[model samples]
Target: MAKVNISLDAELVVEVMVLAGVGSPQDAVEAVVRDYIARGHRTEARTELTEQSLREVEATPQEPQG
Candidate 1:
């Protein structure tokens, strides 16, 4: 496989390591890049966040007996 060079914030790297849950920042970068390249940047983060927000809103029904 060919390799390319890129830069990212150290904090962001740490966060990715934690999220990847493999205990290695190098592995996290490789894993993320592989998936991102394969998916061609296709993402649903916004839609998932919207769905989560809606679910939270619906779960907290307004109290009428104030």
Candidate 2:
């Protein structure tokens, strides 16, 4: 594990610890960072899927309407 020395707000740290259900400040920070990354990944996947669907629709032939 890489050791990092960061200055954070004490009140915010306490809040994060409670919200994350983690006993240590390090664990709370790690959990929040993990959650943030996961959320970004999920958003990226959704965007990719949406673009793929749009491409498929554009590729499909449109029939003439009377």
Candidate 3:
């Protein structure tokens, strides 16, 4: 993987390190980013629409009838 360098506040990096329980700041930040990506994938899986669901929705009446 390609590496990029970015600057962050010392206090923020220390906070992330403590929260992630990792001694290295790089490891802590990487852990947080990976966790964030995994969470997004899980959320997408939960909310994803399927072909069967689309068919079911299409079968339902779209308007009210008196």
* Deviation from truth (RMSD, Å), model 3: 3.4
- Candidate 2, residue 36: the lDDT equals 100
Taking the tens digit of each residue's C-alpha lDDT, what string does model 2 give over 1-66?
A: 878899999999999999999999999998999999999999999999999999999999999989
Q: Give the better candidate number (1 or 3) by lDDT.
A: 3
lDDT value for candidate 1?
Answer: 0.83
All predictions: root-mean-square deviation over Cα? 9.2, 1.3, 3.4
Q: Write the per-residue lDDT of candidate 1 for residues 22-43, one digit (tens) a residue.
A: 6787789988888887676445
TM-scores for the candidates:
0.47, 0.89, 0.76
Ranking by TM-score: 2, 3, 1
Off by over 4 Å in 1: 1-7, 41-66
Worst 10 residues of 3 by lDDT: 43-52
lDDT, candidates in the order shown: 0.83, 0.97, 0.91
How many clashes show up in model 2? 0
Task: Name the weakest run of 10 consecutive residues (lDDT summed) in model 2.
Answer: 1-10
Off by over 4 Å in 2: none
